[model samples]
Target: MNDRESKSKILWTLFKSMFMLSACTFGGGFVIVSLMKKKFVEELNWIEEEEMLDITAITQSSPGPLPVNASVIIGYRMCGITGSIVAVLGTIIPPMVIISIISLFYTEFRTNKYIAIALQVMRAGVAAVIFDVVIKLAQNVLKTKRALYISMMIVAFIATYLFGVSAMLIILVCLGIGIIDLIINLKRIERSAE
Candidate 1:
């Protein structure tokens, strides 16, 4: 395909994927990341799993909701600004429409016990999905050094949950440590090569 045509196709795919994610992801944006992985990595083959996690991390650290930001970055990577616009629009539209509709009859919906139960069930499912995503990400991190990454992950979890440390601080500290470790590893490899 020509450049323009390929770009158009990529934009359309991003739009459709984001729309589906927005519509189907019930609990929150984290669940959408799992859906994005299935659509982008498994189905479209647009990005690798590691790239998705990196994009997710960036999205989390930046302003705005995680899924929308992720879609923007992914779309931009695939096409450009236009792709980002399409992806953002698609991600926003479904939730906006759904929320509008729900708000119209929210009182009635709120009173429905079956609906409430179903929502609770969905919450559990979403939690499981999020946990799965965490495990997958941890596994990827562990590939570099199983013990080290596991230790870092544990420390991060403890710092955030138990010690009540800000997650942003933990992430920044971890990022710095990771960079330093990479530099050291690179030096070691260079020395070995020499």
Candidate 2:
């Protein structure tokens, strides 16, 4: 394919992927990340698993929502700014349309006891899905530093849930530690090479 044709195809693929992710994901951005990995990394082979993880980290650190930011970054990596725009639009459209309709009818439907019970059940499902995603993410992260990452995960959980510390603060601290570790590792490798 020529450059333009290849770019167009890439943009279209990204748009479709983002659309599927935004539509199928019921819970939140984290769940969408798992779905994105399944589609983009496992199914489509558009990006590698490690690259997806790196994208997730960057998306988390930057401003705005995770899924949208991720879509843009992935799209840009795959194609360019045009691909990013297409992916972002695809990710946004489904949720916007669905939420608009739901918001219009929500008040009327929310008062019904059966509907409330159904929603409660759905919440349980969503929680299970979120937990599954967390476990998968933990598994992936733990592959490199099983003990340390697990300990950090536990500490982060306790700090956030029990001690009432902000997740943002924990994330910042972890990012700082990761950067220090990266620098140290690079220095060690460089010195060894020398």
Candidate 3:
């Protein structure tokens, strides 16, 4: 196919993939992230695994919803602003449609025993999915074998889970540290090249 045609096809594919993933996904952004890693990283080989992890970290640290942040990044990477809009629309539309439909049945659905039971079951499933995400992400971080990072992760987990320390605080501190590390590394490289 011609360049324009090929690009169009790829955009369409990205749109369709995001739409389908959003439609079927029940948990939330983390689940969508895992699936995206599987699809774009493992299956399609469109992005590297480390890059996907970086994308996930960036999306999570940002202010917006994870899926939206992810869509924006992925789409921009693939095509540009047009692709980003298409991707965000695809990621959002499914939930909007589902919510619209559910709103029509709000009263009945609220009173439905089966739905309550199903929701309880779904809570367990969601927990499992979240746990899986945690494990995978932790493993990825731990693999780098940086004692400082490993210690920080452990301390951060303890602070958040046990002591109720604010996550935003942790993220901000880590962000500062990362910047410092980058600056130091660059200076070291320059010194070595002298």
Candidate 4:
């Protein structure tokens, strides 16, 4: 295809992929994130696994909803601002429409035994997906083999799970550490060059 045609094709594919993933994903952003990694990093080869991990970290630490945050970054990485807009629309539309419909029939849905049972069952699946994502993230962190990174991961988990510390606090602490590590690495590089 020509340049214009190829760009159009990519945009279309991006929209379609996001829409389908959003429509099918039931649990939340974390669940969808793993699926996105598979689709974008593994299948499409559009994004690197390391980049996806970074995206996951960024989206988790950001203010808004995780899926929307991820959509913005991933879309921007792929096709700039237009891609971000398209991705966000695709990500939001399905949940918005579904929730609207659910609200309309809220009473009926709440009263229905089968729907309740189905939702309860879905929670188990969601837990599994979340667990898988956790394992993958931990593996990535471990691969770095940096004592500080590994220790921070364990400490953060302990602080969150055991102490019930605020996630925002943990994220901020991690960000500070990351910045220090970056600076240290830069200094080391400078010294080596000199």
Among these predicted structures, which one has the highest lDDT? 4
What order do candidates take by lDDT, descending?
4, 3, 1, 2
Which of the numbered candidates is closest to the native, going by highest TM-score? 4
User: What residue runs in model 2 are displaced by over 4 Å at the alpha carbon?
Assistant: 146-150
Please say which candidate is ahead in TM-score: 3 or 4: 4
Native-to-model Cα distance after best TM-score fit, residue 38 in candidate 4, in Å:
0.9
How do the residues 28-51 of candidate 4 rate in per-residue lDDT, one tens digit apiece? Answer: 999999999998999999999999
lDDT (0-100) at residue 76 of candidate 4? 94
Off by over 4 Å in 3: none
Better of 2 and 4 by TM-score: 4
lDDT of 1 by residue, 1-194 (tens): 99888778878878888998889898787889888988999998989888988898888778789889998898898877888899999999999999999999999999999999999999999999999888888778788686767899989988888999997898788888889989999999999999
Query: Which is the better candidate, 1 or 3, if ranked by TM-score?
Result: 3
Candidate 4 segments whose C-alpha is farther than 4 A from its true place: none
Evaluated at residue 113, the lDDT of candidate 2 is 91
Kindly list the per-residue Cα lDDT of model 2 for residues 22-52, writing each as its tens digit.
9977777877877888889999898999899
Which candidate do you rate higher for TM-score, 2 or 3?
A: 3
* Per-candidate clash tally: 0, 0, 0, 0
Model 3 residue 1 distance off true place after TM-score fit, in angstroms: 0.6
Better by TM-score, candidate 4 or 1 = 4
My TM-score estimates for the predictions, one after another, are 0.88, 0.88, 0.95, 0.97
